[model samples]
Target: MANLQLKAIKKSYDNVNVIHGIDLEIKDGEFVVFVGPSGCGKSTLLRMIAGLEEITQGHLLVDGVDMTHQPATERGIAMVFQSYALYPNMTVRGNLSYPLEVSKRPKAEIKQRVELTAQKLHLNELLDRMPRALSGGQRQRVAIGRAIIREPRIFLFDEPLSNLDAELRLEMRIEIAKLHESLGNTMIYVTHDQLEAMTLADRMVVLRQGVIEQVGAPLALYHNPDNMFVAGFIGSPRINFMAADVVATTVGQVQLRIEELAIDSLIMTVQQRLNEGEKVWLGVRPEHFVSADGADCHFSSTLTFAEHLGHTNYLYVDYDQEKTLVIEQRELEKHTNGDSVTFGINAQQSLLFAQSGERIR
Candidate 1:
């Protein structure tokens, strides 16, 4: 296991700066995930850490040793890429033993390690099969097994499950989680899928446009984002945002009027004071909507669409002329499309953001 430190890490192409100065510390045996949309530079940063790309500036320290200029093989790290990257002609046993063979290990040691790694990955029965003869999930397992055979101090997964089917992805997710639990190595995962990050990471580093937006536990970032970008990116079904104008301000609360929802006045607690007429955004997650009788603030809208999952239903209604607001519901009531539905949210469960996209506490 190893702890990693990144100090003012940056990357640029010609005069175009991609990664801004970033400083972070990853604890030993911690499962950290870098999550962001495409073009956000998550992969670039991961490659930099893997010694595949040169650091434009800044330092990378591993286990208290500066390794910014070290070669990939000497970094004691193994990576599982998006593609399986297995040799077509090699059997699983060959694939697993190739690294040891290249390192000139004793034949007996290579045999023992290959069997052990195959057993660990549940690939024993498929050891004699070629990559072309394996399923997608099996191939991925082989890829992981290859990495495991190296007994690396650190593991890097670059969207390793993106190539599998949904069911396979879920299965592989559990497998990876179990592997981490048993191995307890420092692992860094890169993915654009927020749900994957939420499930797998001990902490998530949310990035946007090559800069970090937030870094914290999954639920922490979900419920207590520092900015609108983090708030908007970390949740599924998306959060609802409504435009409002501050109507009044009290000691630790502000009263607002939401014209889009036709709300006359709603009071919400805040840590910051706002001007009487300052524009702010009201943020509410889908699941925060409540029954009308239990609501602090309510509005009515015609249901434009409804998605019925097994345990929950998502209701969508048109808002702000072009935007749609999604409300999560778990009741047994059935409402057809175009039916008027009343949606309510407690003031205490709502969040307030400034027009500049910063959360107002």
Candidate 2:
């Protein structure tokens, strides 16, 4: 296991910058995920760390050694790509031992490494099968086994589950999580899927448009996002945002006007620097919006749509002013598509963002 550190890293193509300066310190044996939308530079940053892309500036260190100028093989890193990248004609054993063979390890050592990796990845039974004979998930496991046979100090995965079906993806995700637990090596995963990142990562780095938006544990980022972007991007069904005006500000409370509903004087214990009459954004997660009353913030709206999701339901409501809000409900009562509903939110659970899309507190 090795700690990886990137300091002021930057990447450019023909003088046009794609990845801005980024600094991150990944602890040894930690699993960190880079998550963002497509074209957001998550993959570019991962490739740079893998030595597949040139570092325009700054330092890349692995285990306290500078490796910015090193070749991919010399960096002691292994990568599993989204495409599987397995040789079509090669058997599973051949594929797993290819890297070791290239490194000129003894034949007996290569065989032992391949056998161990195959066993660890649950591919021992399929060792002699060709890539075409394996299922998508099996092929992916073989790809991972190939990386494991290399005995790399760090493992890098670039959207490795994107090509699998939903059920297969879930199964592979569990397997990967278990593999990380068993290996306990430094692993960096890059993906656009928020749920995958939330479930698999020890900590996550959120990026947007070549810039770092926020970095935190999954629950921490979900509960306390730095801005509207991070809050909206990190959650399933996304957090609901509403335009509101600050009606009053006191020492420990602030009044807000949401469309026609007024949150009459809510207490905010956190010290927030905000001026009077500022237009701020109010964010409420779907699960945080409740059906009961007695909340600091309450509103009544018409249900535009309701999706019955077996265990729970998602209610999409529209205010009189035409702003839409999503609410997640458990033990949901049957309601028509356009039924009127009232939702409540605890002020402490609500988030306030400034006019510039930054979280106010």
RMSD (Å) of each candidate, 1 decimal: 0.8, 1.4
Model 2 worst lDDT run, 10 consecutive residues? 261-270
Evaluated with TM-score, which candidate comes out highest? Answer: 1
TM-score, predicted candidate 1 vs. hidden true structure:
0.99
Instruction: Give one digit per residue, the lDDT tens place, for model 2 in 130-150.
Output: 999999999999999988888
Estimated TM-score for each candidate: 0.99, 0.97
In model 1, which runs have C-alpha deviations exceeding 4 angstroms? none
lDDT of 1: 0.93
Q: Show the lowest summed lDDT stretch of 10 residues, model 1.
A: 264-273
The total of clashing pairs for model 2 equals: 0
